[model samples]
Target: MPRTSTAVIARAKGAPVELATIVVPDPGPGEAVVRVQACGVCHTDLHYREGGIGEDFPYLLGHEAAGVVEEVGPGVTDVAVDDYVVLNWRAVCGQCRACRRGRPWYCFATHNATQRMALADGDPQAGTELSPALGIGAFTEFTLVAAGQCTKVDPAAKPEVAGLLGCGVMAGLGAAINTGGVTRGDSVAVIGCGGVGAAAIAGARLAGANRIIAVDLDDRKLATAQELGATHTVNGRDQDVVAAVQALTDGHGADVVIDAVGRPETWQQAFYARDLAGIVVLVGVPTPEMRIPDIPLLDVFGRGGALKSSWYGDCLPSRDFPLLIDLYLQGRLPLEAFVTETIGIGDVEAAFAKMHGGDVLRSVVTL
Candidate 1:
C-alpha cells in the first residue's frame, strides 16, 4: 500500500520549504520503507533549496536521519521490519571498480530507491516527482530507501543523535580518523571549528593525539571545540594561522593539519601549517567556481606528505556506523552535543537561518 507522508519540500530555487504531502509507495524489490524517528537539519538541505547543489527544484530535503524499518521488500535480508537503523546515503555496490579494488569507501556506484516519491494531489507542486536530496529524503514521517541504506544500530542510541552519523558528523569524524589517520601522540590542528571541524577535533582526541589545536573565527565554536577535546584554540581572525600553529607545536608545526573550511586560502594554510612529511586533509566542500591561487607548484614537491580530499570522510557505512554508535553509547563520543536543538518538521526553514548565522550546531527535526 502507498502512504502519504508530510515532508519538507522545496518547490523552486530560493523559495521557502513547505510542509507538503509526499506519496511514498510500498517498498519494491531490494527496498525498504522506514518510519523516520529523527532527521537533522543540514546545510545541504539549504544548498538544495538555494539551487546550490542543482536545479532539482522539487527537492525532498533532509538526509541525516535515523528510523525503524516498518516494511521490507522481497529479497531484502540486510535489515528486517522493526529494526532500529541509521539511514545512509552511500549503499555501495559490490561490483564497482573501487569496491573491487578493496576501497569500498570510494565506491563509484551507490544505491537509492528506484521509485520516486511523488508530490500528492492538491498541493501546488502536485504531480511533481521529487528528487530526494542525497537519495535519503527523510524529512518526512515515512521514507522508502534501498535496503542497504539502513544500517542497524543499538536501539538505546538516541534517534536525534544517531541520525547525524548519516552525514556531516560522519564526514567530520572520518576526516580525522580515516582520512587524516590521526595517531597516538601526534600533533593535529583543525582549521574551522564548525560541526565538521569540531568532529575532526573529537576524532583526533579519540585517536589519542597529544595536542589538538582548533582554529575558528567564532569564540562560541572554539568553546565547543574545546569541549570536544581541543587542547588549544586559535581565533583565525586575530592570529596568523600558520605562525600560531607552528608556535603551538614548538616550531615544528603540527604533524597533521586538517582544513574543515573548503576555501583555497584555508587549504593553503593547511598546506603550510604542517611539519615536513606531515599529512593535510581537506574535508570541507567548496563551490564549483572556487579555485586555489598563489600556491607555488614547487612547495608541493618540497613538502612531502599526502594531500587528500575527504569525501564523506572516506567512510564505509557498514563498518563505521555501528562502531561510532557504540562509542557514543560508551560515552566516549559526545554525539548528543552535536544536536543543539530539536524542532518540528516545519522548523527547518528557521533552522536554516540559524545555520546561516552560525547560531546552532544542529537543529534536528523530531518526528
Candidate 2:
C-alpha cells in the first residue's frame, strides 16, 4: 500500500523549499523504503531549488542521509528491515560493463526506484511527480530508493555523522584517497576549503600524506581545514596560489593537487600546482557554461601526469562507508567536526541561508 510522508520540495525554480505531503509507495522489486533519521543540507540542494540542475520543476531535495531500513521489496537482499544504512545515489548494476570489468565504482548504469513519489491528494499539486535529487531524494520522513543504494554501516555511529558519507564528505575523502592517490609521504594541496575540501584534507591525513596544504579564499574555512588535518594553509586572496603551493612543497609543487573549487581558474591553478609527473584531481562541480581552462598545449604535454575528474569520488559505497564508519567509531576520523549545527525540517530555509554566508559546514536536519 502507498503511504504518505512529509517531505521538503521545491515547486518552482528560485523558490523556497516547502514542507509538504508526499506519497511513498511500498518498495517494488529491487527497492527499499528508508525511515530517515537525519539529512544534511548541501549546496547541491540549493542548486536544485534554483533549477540549476534541470527543468524538473518539482524536485525532492536532500540526499546526504542516514536511516533505518523499514522494508525491503521482493528480490532485495542487499539490506534488511531495521538495518542502519547510509543512502547513496549510485546503485551499481552488476551486469554493466564497468561492473563486469571489476570497476563497479565506475558503473555506467546506476539504478533508482522506478515509481515516482508524488504530491498527495490534498495539495494543489496533487499527483505531480517529483524528481528526487541525485535519485535518492531524502529530505523526508521516509524515502524510497533502489535497494542497492542502502549501504549498511555500524548503528553505533550517530546518524548525523555517518550520513555525511552519503555525499559531499565522501566526495572529498574519495577525491584524495581514491582519485588523487595521496599516499604516505606525498604532498597534497587542496583548493577550496569548503566541506568537501576539508574532507579531502582529512582523507590525505588518513592516507598518510606528509603535508596537506589547504587553499581557500576564506580564513574560517581554512581554520576548519586545519582542524580536519591540514598541515599547511594558503589563502588564495593573499598570495599567488601556485607559488604558495610550490613554496609549501619546497619549490617543485605538491605531488597531488586537488581543485575542489572546479572553476577553470582553479583547475588551471591545480594543473600548475603539481610536481612534475604528479596527479591533479578535480572534485568540484562546474557550471554548464564553464569551459576548459585555456592552458598552453605545450604545458599539458610537458607536465606528464594524470589529470582526472572525480565523480562522487569514484567511490564504491558498500566498500567505503563501512570502513569509514569504523574509523569514526575508533576516533581516528573526526566526522563530528563537520557538523556545524542541527536543525529541524522546518529550519531548512534558514540552514540554506547559513550555507550562503559560509558560516556553517553542514546544517543537518535531524528528525
Candidate 3:
C-alpha cells in the first residue's frame, strides 16, 4: 500500500512552502523507505523554494536528515531494516570515473531513489512528481531514497543532532580537514561564521590548528565559533579581515583561509589572507549572477597555493558519517550545540526566516 505522509512542498518559485499530503511508494529495487525522525532546515532548501537550484517545481524540501530504515529493496545489503541512519546526497556509484580512481568523494555520478514521491492532493492514484531536495527530501514522516543514501550509525546518537552530519556540518568540517588540510600548529581563518564556517573552525581545532580565527559580520556567530574552538575572532564589518588574520598570525597570514561566504569579495579576502603557499577552500555557494572580476594573474603565480571548492566537503559518507557521530557521542565533538532549535514540519518557512536573519545555526524539523 502507498503511504500518505505530511510533507513540506514548494509548488512554484518564490512562493511559500505548504504542508501537503505526499504519497511515498514502497521500496523498489536499489531503494529504501526511511521513517524520517529529523531533518535540518538548510539554505539549499531555501534555494529550491526560490528556484535557484533548478526548474524542478513542486520540490519536496528538506535534507540533512537522519532516520530509521523501515524497508529496503532487493540487493540492498549495506543497510538493513530498523537501522538508525543518516541520509546523504552523495551515494557514490563505484563505477563512476572518480570512484574508479579511488576518489569516491569526487564521484561524478551519485545515485538517488529511482522512483519519485508524489503529491497526494488531486488523486491518490496519479499525483504530481515532486523533486526531492538534494535527493533526500525529508521534511516528512517518511521518505524514499536510494538504499546507499542511508549510512547506518550508532543508535545511541540523538536523531536531531546526528542528522546534521548528513550535510552542512560535514561540509564545514571537510572544508577544514579535507580541502584546506589544516594540520597541527597551522593557522586557519574561516570566513562567514555560519553553521558551516563554525564547523570548519571545529574541524581545524580537531586537526590541531594553533591559531583558529573566526571571521564574520555577526558577533553572535563569532561567539559561537569561539565555543567551537576558535582561538581568535574577527568581525568583518569592524576589521580588515586580511589584516586581522595576518596580525593574529604574526603578520605572516593564516596557513589556510576558507571562504564560506562564496561572494567575490569574500573569495578575494580568502585569496589574499592566506600565507605563502597556503591553501584556500571555497565552500560557499554563489548565485548565478555573481562573478569574480579583476583577479590578478600575477598573484595566482606568486601566491603558490591551492584554491579549492568543496563539494559537500569532499566527504565519503561511509567513512566520515560514523566517525563524526562517534566523535559527537564522545565529549570531543559538540553536535548538540549546532541545534539552535527544533520545530515541526510546518515551521520550515519560519525557519528559513531565522536562517536569513542569522539567528540559528540549524533549525531541525523533528518528525
**RMSD to native for every prediction?**
0.8, 0.7, 1.3
Clashing residue pairs, candidate 2?
none
The models' CA-based lDDT, in order, is 0.94, 0.94, 0.93
The TM-scores of all predictions, comma-separated, are 0.99, 0.99, 0.98
lDDT of each residue in 68-182, candidate 3, tens digit only: 9999988999989999999999999999889999999999999999999998866443489999999999999999999989999998999999999988999999999998888
Write model 1 residue lDDT over 1-367, tens digit each, in one string.
8999999999999999989998999999999999999999988889999999999779999999999999999999989999999999999999999999999999999989999899999987687999999999999999999998999999999999999999989999999999999999999999998888988999999999999999999999999999999999999899999999999999988999999989999999999999999999999888899998687789998999889999999999999999999999999999998999999998999999999999999999999
Candidate 3 Cα lDDT to native: 0.93
Model 2, TM vs. native: 0.99
Residue clash pairs of candidate 3:
none
* lDDT tens digits, residue span 14-57, model 2: 99999999999999999999999999999999999997789797
After superposition, the stretches of candidate 3 with alpha carbons farther than 4 Å from their true spots are: 121-126
Task: Give me candidate 1's TM-score against the actual structure.
Answer: 0.99
What is the clash count for each candidate, in the order shown?
0, 0, 0
Ranking by lDDT: 2, 1, 3
1 against 3, candidate with superior TM-score: 1
